[model samples]
Target: MRPVNATDRTPADLLRSALATDPARPLVTFYDDATGERVELSVATFANWVAKTANLIQNELAAEPGERVALLLPAHWQTAVWLLACSSAGVVADIAGDPSAADHVVAGPGRFEDGLACSGERIALSLAPLGRRFPQPPAGYADYAVEVPSQGDLFRPYAPVDPEAAALIVAGAELTGAEVVDRSRADAPGLDLTGPGSRLLSGLPYDTWDGLSAGLYAPLAAGGSVVLCRNLDRLGEDALAKRIESERVTATAR
Candidate 1:
């Protein structure tokens, strides 16, 4: 392997950076609107969460490095933690709305129908009823949301990971068939998630690329915190500005 250098960046680099500077800082938080669940991670906990999650994925899901593990999830705390875990393991997470038929689908019961519909296998991270509950959880799927915890979890001791590589595939400014016909294609941008003072106010729908990438991956990649709201519109002009001020978020890209 080439000697690690500044140019040879990876997702693990971001985690390490956060660890060095402010390991106890708040990196990300996910709030569940339905269950009122709040999941929070500090820089150190964020790092560990990713490691354990990655280890589990590698061991159980056979998520080889660079293999795209797709997430069909709403903006839940578990989903946020999984994003961090995927990046740490160097597994490419599929956030594309147009998932191929063969992709492994992981989703919550009620909110992730599209994810479940598209996935070959399903995993539930929580025990809460997902509206029209399935007679039984999908055969190949496992309930992981409730199984994994932030501390003393089975995978929590996973070793630290490298930072430079395809931590996750980030999508930006994508247009649909009609929208593409009408608009231009910009090389989708990667928000420097691990950049300083990164915090998220995810006001977008989970299924949308911008929502998932910008709202989710951006924060996880940089070891930053995710600020979730039931609806983006809830982050109105004043509320958004106030939240930013309160959080002291830096380098917002929007």
Candidate 2:
């Protein structure tokens, strides 16, 4: 693995580099057994989503660097977009914390009621098969599908973010943007993510370090891609193996 100057670059920077290298390579493939949903995004497509999401965060929500954005989501593809959006906007992602304390909250259908308790701005995602617009949006919350499409495909933060700013608060641990980048670079080799073509099958939940590494950080750091599975516990061993074979997954973090 190459040494990264974490003090100079954030996770979003790494993703941009990856996009430059191979825009057509698959960056994320998501699976939801319960919903029979499967979505694949190339680097360019994923980056487009990230840009729109970041624009939403910066322009609509007016979230600033170091602000906390609570993410009440599963290991779905849209969840990954939100993660990168927060990083790109220099907002701290809170995956396992009190939503009410966050400056902004993004919630899925099941967590909509709990998200309403948050005093900050809220965005609700239906997590529909095609990421469809919420049929009946909550009274006060913005619907992600309704707003994100109108945002710009390119994103530029209002101000440059400090690498030392807090970027994530997950599972009782706070990590700066620099720390997150450094750890992702360091963890990639150990995770057997050596190059761009490497594909990782991750069954881990996003709230844990292992999950974040496999699902987002490690892949981006190594210029690789991820196959993220939600409700993976429902898959039988045979089914799992078939998926690994079909997706051509080279590594797994479960």
lDDT of 1: 0.53
Candidate 1's C-alpha runs over 4 A off are 1-8, 32-37, 96-100, 111-121, 127-140, 146-200, 206-213, 216-226, 234-254
**Model 2 misplaced stretches (Cα beyond 4 Å):** 1-8
Q: Write model 2 residue lDDT over 136-249, tens digit each, in one string.
A: 898779999999999999999989978788998889899988888888888898888988678999989998888998998899888889999999999999999999999999
> Tens digits of per-residue lDDT for model 1 on 1-254?
11122422444444556577678888765444555545656878767766667667766666656556667666555566676566556565555434454245566655355555554545565434332344455555666643344323334314443343344443533222222111111111244344445565665665555665555545644445566655345345886687667756553534
Error of 1 at 92 (Å): 2.1
Give residue 130's error in model 1 in angstroms.
Answer: 16
Q: What's each prediction's TM-score? A: 0.63, 0.96
Q: Which pairs of residues have clashing backbones in candidate 2?
A: none
**Which residue window of length 10 is worst by lDDT in model 1?**
180-189
lDDT (C-alpha, whole model) for all candidates: 0.53, 0.88
